[model samples]
Target: MSTADSLAKVIATLDWDGDLGPASLAVDEAEQLRSRLGDGATRWVAGAVEQSLTALHGQIHDSLAPWPIIRTFTRHVLTATLLRLADQDRLPVDTGAIDRDLAEDIVARGIPLSDITQALRSMQREWLSLLIDAALGVRPDGIGVVPALATSVTGTMDAWIGAATDAIVEERRRVYLAEQVRIRSAIELLVTAEPVDVEAVTQLLRIPLIGWHLSCAIGVPPGGTVERRVLDGLVHLFARVVGSERMLRYETSAGTVHLWVTTDRPARTPRVEDLRVPAPLLVGIGEPHPGPDGFRRTFLEASDALRLAGSLGDNGGVSYGDAALAIVLSRDEERARWFVEHELRDLATDSPEMADLRNTLRTFFDTRMRIAPAAERLFLHRNTLINRLDRIQAVLGHGVAERPAETQAALVLAELFTRRPEDPSTGRHEFGA
Candidate 1:
């Protein structure tokens, strides 16, 4: 065969799917090429190729370190490609196997096709440059054959990459849809208030079966977008702060995020002020409790806490610990209102006189209704505190000194009922007192 015909036939050898016998290339043609190149030339080229591949692997590693599966798979495919080329006389290149496995790895790792494409292009460029230089060193006149070699190498690469890219895209879509279904199913099981198979759930979610769990319910303002990476970083941050690994999260159709984090030991759970999260996100963290029952309860607690968070002050995350009583009372609006009116009378109204009385009462109760501590807390003298207490008794028709427990409860209900949803800081003196 003419030189052109021979090179064309060699290129055709790489096009086989699974019919590679012992070698991908024809024996006679391989022998002829080896003879033309000389054995020493083949050894030198293979060694250079190996060193070049190592360097390229390092570069790929740096670029795709975040995706370990893709990084590892790319390295494997490069090594396998080198092996096929080096031993073309005895082994065939099964590009199909490489393509299939690479595609699967990409999908499983959640890597984008664009990233894989970029890596392939980088490898193709490096391989072509190294191979062409090796070819020129072996045969000065071999420059003419470089184009054919390039076409053969790139054609095989393009075929495999194209197929793998398509396969991974389709697989990723399938997995994404399947994952959404799984998330929905898991949520239904959690919120139905029925008995759930906790073991089955733990196995399915790959989370701890029982541990101290804190649930956080996060809601973004309308028109705000929560990217996946941001959410991932936030979850990692929470894990670090809480010191736990058994964490699970779900995003609702309403664009709210629910997270359940489990820890082996329960400490004083951190408040939202302690966590690093977006300012626009409204967060409510539940008290940490143990086991699957704790998991369900904490979720409910966080969800409920989020509702009353706006009235607590600041858009920062609210903890159930601080807002639980207010949240509970606020659930029944009419009852809370009625209780506030009957118990405290006009003290429930928003007015300067009512504010002075509420502040004094709050400080009085917080200080255990002590005459001295209440005076100190209110920054008032003993005589002034006495006067305020008398005025408070006149308004409520009961002396403050008589009903300490009932007085405290009434003060709390008054604060809860009078809380302005738009301005959480309205009753700060009353709350803090």
Candidate 2:
């Protein structure tokens, strides 16, 4: 650590001109590498990494591959900053903290050395592949380039930079793909994965085990890549279980997919509510799971969306996440009361006939406002309706006279009673509707 050596290191760092060559050695290596390596791609991965920085604000990266690299780097740097703040119990970066000196601070402080280092090592290969696949955008799964269908700037995804540790993106891809397949296959089998089907999944998808009754889930892209295969394969099985109902599968982790399933028939998407969930994870297909907000979407929403699509038969897709609170946890007596009280405001109360009406209302709303020849087709009397009405109004109070409020209140209750809280693992009993 001589002063001249330190000065040389500083100058060399400043130059970023060449590796192993003296600070003065200027090589056309970058351009040559770009020409030699990019396959006519716009940017070279090596140059991208060499020049990458973790800024306080957002970056100015190109729209493809290396974007993940920049994003991952940016996130880790930001994370390191936050962690530092957390350690010192002070807020270092915030809306105003993009102080421009954070980089120097990180370099000086060696922030999050172990974490950033490990993440970078792990993410290396993915970053390199990103140079190729970001532009490809999942279309590669379909034979040749497939003519790069009118791609749009839908959103961005990032892989934490692993190149910093001298690892490449390819290696990380192996790790990322293996983990992703494991999760996807697990969820696939957990819900509908059969024992016989397990072997094929293991061989094809490389997932190892299929546990029973676990509320596991996996990230799914909106359309392309693996999502199509996963959802399309499940369609037939879903069709058997609930004819004419919609199905949906949201990645619930990424911003890339706002996957939506729509149709003109019956459907069901389990509204997200706090419930026991398997270990939550994030992957590259979409966005990083923003935690519970990310995991909030349940297989139920995807199911409902698919069912609806089948009904009207209009094809649809699954979607994304910015984090969502699962409403299932709120389906308790308080929330049920709160929903009615808020929506109905004046329509929440208890009366016997109202109790019966409540039952009918729950059925009607849960059935999506269709209580017609079905209810009457069972053969009821006009007085039956009249009595139900009287009790409903009696319990709901003066606001029940207000058609809008009354309708909304009844709807919330109906939906409330329909939460799927039947996790045998938690010993919570099923709600017998």
Candidate 3:
């Protein structure tokens, strides 16, 4: 046969299937070469895996693929490639299952596909070189067959790479879906008042259950979306503020995030003014509380505070301490309104005159009913303040001092429920300011 015909024959007879049975003279010859290599083939695979690992390390600083996983995958690829060459027929390597498993793990770890492909390419080079050297060592006259063997090696490696690409995409979709389900289940369990296995939940969510937790409810404007980078930035900020290394977060479909920063010891509540929240984002923070029960309590508090902030059109952070009364009173809106109207009477109206009277009353209560300080704070003459107080008393048909606690509580509830339009330029409610 001519040289071209001889090359064609070699290529045609080369087995792509991994069958070990004798199919032709070429198969017998290839099998003899593999048998002669013996432990040398094993050594080649090991060497190739090491080389590939080294290459990967140089390129990727943080790959989620563990040492054992990488080694196992590399060995399978090399072993299957070698088997195909020995069989000298079409060797269909079964790397689909392994690829899918590995791809899912890598995707979950957030490792880029480029890193995986780079490692695979490194292994391909090492395996090809080793196989060629082995072939020449066993048969010095096999130089002419080198092209056909190299073609087979490249073809098999390329197929593996294609399969891996598809696996990576599929695995990414699977991981995203699985993660959503896991987070939803965890949130439900943690928020409910039902008895729970704290240990099991901690393991499932991978967060500390018995530490000091400072919960925060972070919200963007309605219909907004929170990107991954934004969430990461928020986590870093919260961790730094609370001096905690551990944190747990869950993002809702409406672009709200519930985050908990945990520490071993008590942590100070982050100051609202110090938060420096940006525009279009509002944050509600719960006080630091300890243990599993505290976790649920703090989360509830933060969520309540967040709703209050949103309703009040607050543009910045609001702590539970700041919104505690509003949150509590707003819980029973009907009862709260009745209490406020009953206590304040005519002063409970949203009229400007009533608002002024309520402010004066609030100032009076704040100053311990000291007329001098209350008058000064309200910027009113002493007699003017006294007259307003008399008017307030007449509206209630009693003395303000007669029901100080109830009057004060009623004033707070009235202020909380008063409907006020948000400032156009500042995006803040008058009460918030």
Angstrom error at residue 88, model 3: 11
On TM-score, the candidate that comes out on top is 3
For residues 307-340, what per-residue lDDT tens digits would candidate 1 score against the true structure?
A: 5664554466678999777777677667877877
TM-score of each: 0.63, 0.25, 0.70
Best by lDDT: 3
Write candidate 3's Cα lDDT for 3-79 as tens digits.
33443333233222222221212343335435633444434445555666666677667644576665666656665
Q: Write the per-residue lDDT of candidate 2 for residues 127-195, one digit (tens) a residue.
A: 323323432443324222212211100011122232232233333454567767665554444334234
What are the Cα lDDT values of the candidates? 0.64, 0.33, 0.70
By lDDT rank, best first, the candidates go 3, 1, 2
Scanning candidate 1 in windows of ten residues, the lowest lDDT window is 424-433
Error of 2 at 306 (Å): 13
TM-score order of candidates, best first? 3, 1, 2
How close to the true structure is residue 300 of candidate 2, measured as C-alpha lDDT? 36
